[model samples]
Target: MNFKSILFALTTLVTLSLAIVLNPQITSPSADTKWRAGDTRTVTWDTENVTGGPIPEGMKGTIKLGYLDPKDGPNEHLNWDLGSGFDLNKGSFVVTLPSELETKRTYIIVLMGDSGNASPQFTITAAR
Candidate 1:
């Protein structure tokens, strides 16, 4: 191959390698649903695709696990606990399911930026 072709191939390889090395992309559920109603369901997040800087004061995202109560709000019943939200990088919280929800139910998993739910659209659904 000529010098130009050889140089282009090398550059492409280096670019792809750098992207794989620096960025981590993992999309997995953040809850352990093997427990019963009274049991504590702990959820964890992957810092791979997490933006922000480092741990502790890392990503400015909120990871919530629970079903919101429908009477107050649609799906609001599964909202576990009141004011039980936590900032990302800090750690996970046990979704305190309400008494009304005896069996397992599906809840919304919302991960927002520092600007609350208005951040981007990093939200998903998790089954209890």
Candidate 2:
């Protein structure tokens, strides 16, 4: 191959490698997952290729269990905060579903704070 071609390939490789190494990754709660009301499930996450860094000077992270509209942002009607002030490095935590649900509706789980991530669209069936 020509020298220019080789150099271009090398630069591309380095750029991709740095992108993966510098960005954080969320590793759990497969997309479009379903969970019933009054159920307990574990939510997991990870930071790929990341090591020690500066600790946050404020709140760590919060777990938000609620609803979202495709047009607007958050749906306050179905909003419920699962947790708050949790350590970003906690990795995983158990979440208990509400025992009662008013109606069969779609919901979502979000991890926001020092890090931001979300679960696939999930539904909460009315408790039997």
Candidate 3:
């Protein structure tokens, strides 16, 4: 193969490897998940995908509640901090949904850290 072709192949492999190592895959709150306002739910991810094995001590991450209204076009709004300063290595955390949240099917959970990873869109219904 030509030198340029070899170089391009190597670069592409490195980039894909880095992406796999750096991005943690969210596993919970799946596409079929339905959470109720005022309820506590567990958010989980694949710890194996985390770089350097587990997250280091004192390394923290935040979880945010995101909203995308179909009526409002494609703008996604991260409107609330569900929790923060969490250990990303544990692979999971429990969060209490705010009782005041409106019933919506477009709610998503975003895990914020070195690289933000989001869960599939889920439903959040009004509290009973």
Where does the lowest 10-residue lDDT sum fall in candidate 3? 49-58
| Per-residue lDDT over 1-128 for candidate 2, one digit per residue giving the tens place of the 0 to 100 score | 99999999999999875544222244555555666778787777664443333333443667767666677755534366676766666666677878775444456667775445566666677667
Give a tens-digit lDDT track for model 1, residues 1-128. Answer: 99999999999999875454211122333233333444344544455454432334544444444554446554433243323345565445444433344443344454443422211112232224
Candidate 2 vs candidate 3: the TM-score winner is 3
Measured against the true structure, the TM-scores of the candidates, in listed sequence, are 0.38, 0.59, 0.76
> Model 3 compared with the native: what TM-score?
0.76
Off by over 4 Å in 1: 1-32, 51-87, 112-128
For each predicted model, how many residue pairs clash, with residues at least 3 apart or on different chains? Answer: 8, 0, 0
lDDT of 1 at 127: 28
TM-score of 2: 0.59
